[model samples]
Target chain A: MNFTRRFTLAGLLAVLLPVSATVAQVDSLPSWNSGSARQAIVDFVGRVTREGNPDFVPVPERIAVFDNDGTLWCEQPEYFQAAFALDSVKAMAPKHPEWKQQEPFKSFLAGDRTALAEQGEQALLTLVTAAHSGKPTDEFSKSVADWFSTARHPRFNRPYNELVYQPMVELLAYLRVSGFKTFIVSGGGVEFMRVWAEKAYGIPPEQVVGSSGVTQYQLDAAGKPSLLKTAKVQFIDDGPGKPSGINMMIGRRPILAFGNSDGDHQMLQWTMAGSGARFAGLVHHTDEVREYAYDRQSKVGKLDEAWDEARAKGWTIVDMKQDWKTIFREKP
Target chain B: MNFTRRFTLAGLLAVLLPVSATVAQVDSLPSWNSGSARQAIVDFVGRVTREGNPDFVPVPERIAVFDNDGTLWCEQPEYFQAAFALDSVKAMAPKHPEWKQQEPFKSFLAGDRTALAEQGEQALLTLVTAAHSGKPTDEFSKSVADWFSTARHPRFNRPYNELVYQPMVELLAYLRVSGFKTFIVSGGGVEFMRVWAEKAYGIPPEQVVGSSGVTQYQLDAAGKPSLLKTAKVQFIDDGPGKPSGINMMIGRRPILAFGNSDGDHQMLQWTMAGSGARFAGLVHHTDEVREYAYDRQSKVGKLDEAWDEARAKGWTIVDMKQDWKTIFREKP
Candidate 1:
């Protein structure tokens, strides 16, 4: 080998090695010291979680709760739970005569999202009650599974399950690795969300609490058994009810909370009010190109009250356009 | 050092090495080869769990459940739930006038274990109903917490929390490590157990399924919020109820099960019958010296039909006297 050829080959190898190292670094989260906002999350979590630290929480008390809809997922255009109810109303349209002429029901059946949206929270509640109640809990769950298998997000053109933010998915896994028992406290139907939560979030059904209707168990003449759902509303898991549900179901206050709207404000407040270290983050949807983006004044997933409080309370505002490098699952 | 001295030291080190290796190996579970029994459990679980693994259960279909009392924890001398009821009755004696003359309450207040035993399941149910009913779930939890703090097991003279078997604790942790979400399905009062389950079992109260009394949330005078318990019997979490509760609460069949008596037989059978790899183990209380020894005909923690079937069904029989080198938590 000539000396000039050897020198050229060695120089090329040196350049390639540095390039590979930079690529590997890009694949992981950037350095925690990058900014004060990211560092706040890291510092609070680290101090409270470190053994023997003054603010160190016991393992049993290491509960971290998150709002499922717009916190860990994309609830744009419509909330996912609302979407489930809308689809259910459509699917069950043939079975009921009253829904054919019902205002919200007719709008839901006709796939008129604009009309349904105008009907507001009360209409959403009516839709949810009609679809979730008056059937056996198991049967309702089966219907949800069937619907999830076939339904795709209108804008994303992907199944609702695939529309979950990849960044939030990583955050859930990261918290679990750090010994926090993550729970989904949402305003969605409890039985409905529980059906697919374990697989999608790695959180068990029992850990996923939400709005619930009354349920009863009974036996048939041949001794066959089943669970029956009644028209009675047991609890509405939203606003202040989110914290109450957390206290009732988990029996502990959360150390960290993630939310997006005023509905989750109470939960974040309750979490942050705890004495030790805490974290409260709000996701601000600001990107319109890669994802649907609307916040403050949006009818669905409104962010006005929470956005003001996030700034006042010093909560981390995750700018969708800047903070996240990716959104949904990578296309194969 | 001289050659002879050095040789003697090397000889001693060789002898000590094997003993150290043996101790380390014994600290972990024995490397038992997969036999027919173990294979049955593995195969059933694998089939139900594998993605597209034929028996590939969907997320909603991935419901695995379990029983508490004799199944997950040690229940001897009397059911732990019953013990809690008895203690509550005694503590509330000063508040209730009828208890002084009530048959079961009198027996409980007098600390007459024999009298309570003579009354059997019917009398015990009456006692549980009287003590556990008629209060909001939260208030009932406070009562239980107060009782548990001061109550000591009659035999061990230790708090009930300290009486839990160490081996069973490890098994629960191991199963969780293997992707199984455990639940406590028992004939015990739900409100009573749920209060402290998180602290003791690493399972939140929501995951606890047990016998329950009907409760209603209402506003008291001055608009104070309260929950009122009714006399209505909601559900009995025992025998067939165990499987039923699992289906209703978790919406899934467990791939693994553990129990010590006939009350748990149906649960084990249900788990085993699921189409895939399943594991069923029975804890045989054979250690008379370290713990109580009773089986086949004992009034409490009885083992009879389940014991005979366990061997025939190829369930692992955990011999408490032999299998565990240590039973309870090591004293600090």
Candidate 2:
């Protein structure tokens, strides 16, 4: 039979499949399935992906925005970028004396994690700015590459890059295969994210939108070079800023959004508000053994109010331990 | 017969066929039987696109970057963006007294194209900056959209947006079908190109790199509104800047580069400088009946030095009047 007839038959079969049967079938879906979460994912994927379904998003409109740090990857102990910046500060400390005297810089140099936390967001910003500032974008990129090559996570004892969640990687690839253009919309520095995102996440630099620092291009007798100045917050890519960034950068509202904390709550709200077939997923760090737990009270990647709202909104809550077969890449 | 027997029969037939007869058969390609230029295109495409050819580039790497204004569309009396800026200045003139007193602005208001040209690049920059600066990006986008909707090309009497070369549009789409990512690297403002590029050219905004203005996000005390400032020059996407912009923005060197003037000669050179397979083509305006034909002495989109260099480089020169079956969309 022709495509139209085949599609019609498929549509009828889908309607005839009882909901209870579908739920029961999903419940037996290997050890990788848990709660109602796996069912929600499969059901959403099935309906929108069905050929003649009313909810089918055309390939062009199937854009999905994902928060990188905690959503797509493990951002525990601290955000991976923050950890990168912290190590960068220590590595470059011998070259600059001013950092030794500066408050947050001094605390960082002293390896005082408690003191660094005590300094709060402003202190973290200072630390990032001190390490990431003053160099050309290319030079900073080289530094990041150099550091990432050797840097290992203190607890995992693996290279920081390798600590990216394997399950999320598979999900990203799956979405792309299903005609979604995945974008990393994060609060990290744009230049900082671009340097590693393509290699780690398979998302290109242009598709990554984030907070950025002021940059200037200058010409001397030696020709032109783009220089990065001290971090004066250019645009913060978080909360409502995520939607604004999506508008300015992608110029399209995403159909799917994934987040792990309240920082990404506004993005999810904006995406879910779109009048179309949409999906919102929240990652709940509920496994204390495989990965670090304690979400509501965690200093970083906190899942407070968003967790309750996600439950009420029927957003898929990915229970890390139960939903994932493997947390990171398998050892050779 | 099975595949092995068919392949053997084809090999035997190839050997049995007379060499001179085969040469004659290949030479009888419909367009090639008529002209050498047509033959060149057919031969080049066949050789480079053949699956087993040594020079064959994988479809994924078959990126082609084209200069927009004169290469793919007309830019006669002035650059289209320049014309847009002039119309915008006129529309905004009632609100500003400063423009009436300004030198280049006063000249623009007086409607003298000669005076505007005499103002040179600096004067043109001033005009563009004055017209496009200080507005929010969205407001500028809406202004561009509104202006494009009503503005007509003086010669064609068609909306400026409709004046794109039909042949080039076909070429872009054809290349895309054959696995090429065609990008528009223009001298127009990046934000300006972004507003309508996807709709007009099927090239996403992320694929566009052009001259840019500084932008900043600002929030009012009432927290009611935030805006993106469009101000002084951020980067000029022309000449040496084109290669740098492509590298910094796209992160990949194009295998094919097309241009119509000297400004694009550098871009073509950069593409040709790549180690492996490459192709460079120049769109020569030689049809006065269907389109404007000035080349050597044209003030805008001048083509003097590039003409001689293209010959030396063995780059294909498209004769507009002779080669194209159609010009603008409105043409018969």
Candidate 3:
């Protein structure tokens, strides 16, 4: 109506913006570059959330699941949970002198990754059980919390929690704003993730479904009750287990799913197989400059099968180096 | 100024209120009688919700768990789930011709309760697995919904879903309004309860933790994925299993817990054992006229040891006859 000012687009945007802008900005995912990966996510969310659109899903059924490790954060040198476990093993070694002579334990305590790898999964599981179980749940949670507080990534030299992908964080927040319930369906231990997932990824403990050990209810002489974590592995929320875990926990088919490795193959399949406008994306670790680049050959977070599947299914492959404007939320 | 508007308390309230009242009213639990039972619930909620009070719990931590069967609805003669199971057996009997000659199946089909009871828990479990499992999760949910649509309690001749306790429903609403997250932690099948719990009790599917049989993920030729319910028993959410289920699903110890039988003993125990102001309540069925009153010797929902523990531990024992102004949410 009025041509009082000859303002450039940049000037207009600067004038319209707050001193410190938040998630309520026009560009919802600021950390994500203007790439096909970002566009795919934005388009999917818009189509499903549009009121009069044929693809519009009701708010209740709008469930989006994401795998934690390399999808949301770095899982390069080793999974952050594995680091915690190794730290735990070292911390508890004083209490058990027998571990010095034990096969897996001896190799593990000696920092012999080659020897540990040769021992296979069962040996690694033995180390995990010794490190993660046989304590009260509260104690286990506290230990996890403490580890997340102090433990730094071997490559990043930052707290494990701080290594979370900023673009993914924005995506989670964006999905949540569009009335989608975001859940962490990870291969990581549920107890470990519950301690910090909410703080890092904005997912509550109840919304997280992951591998877990059985916890027993114990009552003390003073009538106080506690859940004691046992050595038994109750459920593994990886690969095929993801779908079953989702059914057991969420009890509904998710419309959107994200992951970076083969561990997420089944979950993405389950999500995509649902009849409707569904979204599944794999975060390809191609950003060697900012993050570790590993695919088809990495010992941890092996991405071969899921990468092929994503391509075959036309699922969005987030070339991390090309797609993300930024990686970590915080600086080293 | 007020002298011109002299009015009785009822007249004042009437004039102050709208034509239709709702949860915003001063008396949060309108269906609850002015007894110690109601007062106990009110007082516990007040202390825990009031800001600046030392006993006040934060909103997120104000988790309330209620056992579904007798705690929230009628479990007389048999559990509503059991009734569903019987109807399912009859509906499925034609498909399985061998059931006519089978011991438990034959006794169940013939409606020989004495013989079925002689066959005991294992026999009943066989019937449950046969009736409930093997179909897709959604199909089983549909079957359960169909049964609920047609089925009614024999004593009251009302739809089974209509038999949810009015007082407890009001309590659930009241607690929810006071910053509490209400959850149904029941001995019933998780899948069965999830189908209706949201509409019936305002608890969402994810918030429900219960007994479950394992569900396997299946992908059809068309690439559509479905979760197929298997006959394998996964977890029992009764007695000690209740607390474990709570731990696994919720990952947080609830502050308030309600139950009506010994099956809920550990849940209530774990809840009360939490630090700070806590509430553990048992709905004592004492209204033989309005609803069946059975305890100690009753096979279904036997309230023996929990009855004694309630007295010993000073847990609120809701005398249904004295405490509830009404029974079911709707009349026959």
Q: State which candidate has the highest lDDT.
A: 3
Per-residue alpha-carbon lDDT of candidate 2 for residues B1-332, written as tens digits (9 for 90 to 100)? 12353245423333344222333343322211234454455455545555566776665567789999888778976788988987888888899888788878888888877988798888877777777888866688899899888998898888777888776776675455445688998887777777788877788876777776655545457433334656545557787667656654554568888899888877887787666777788888998898889888988888988788899868888888787767775443
Can you tell me the DockQ of model 1? Answer: 0.15
lDDT of 1: 0.69
lDDT of 3 by residue, A1-332 (tens): 01233344543443333212322356778888897999899888878876567898887899999999999988878888888998998989999999899989899889898999898999977888888888998898889888887887777778888989999999997887677899999989998888888888889888889988888888889878788999987888888889988888888889999999998998999898878899999999998889888989998889998788799979999998999989988664
Docking quality tier of model 2: incorrect
Q: Against the true two-chain complex, what DockQ does each candidate achieve?
A: 0.15, 0.10, 0.34
In model 3, what are the clashing residue pairs, if there are any?
A: none
Name the candidate, 1 or 3, with the larger lDDT value.
Answer: 3
Q: How far in Å is the alpha carbon of B5 misplaced in model 3?
A: 36
lDDT of 3 at A313: 79
Models ranked on TM-score: 3, 2, 1
TM-score of each: 0.66, 0.71, 0.91
Ranking by DockQ: 3, 1, 2
TM-score of chain B of each: 0.79, 0.84, 0.90
Question: Each candidate's chain A: what TM-score?
Answer: 0.84, 0.85, 0.90
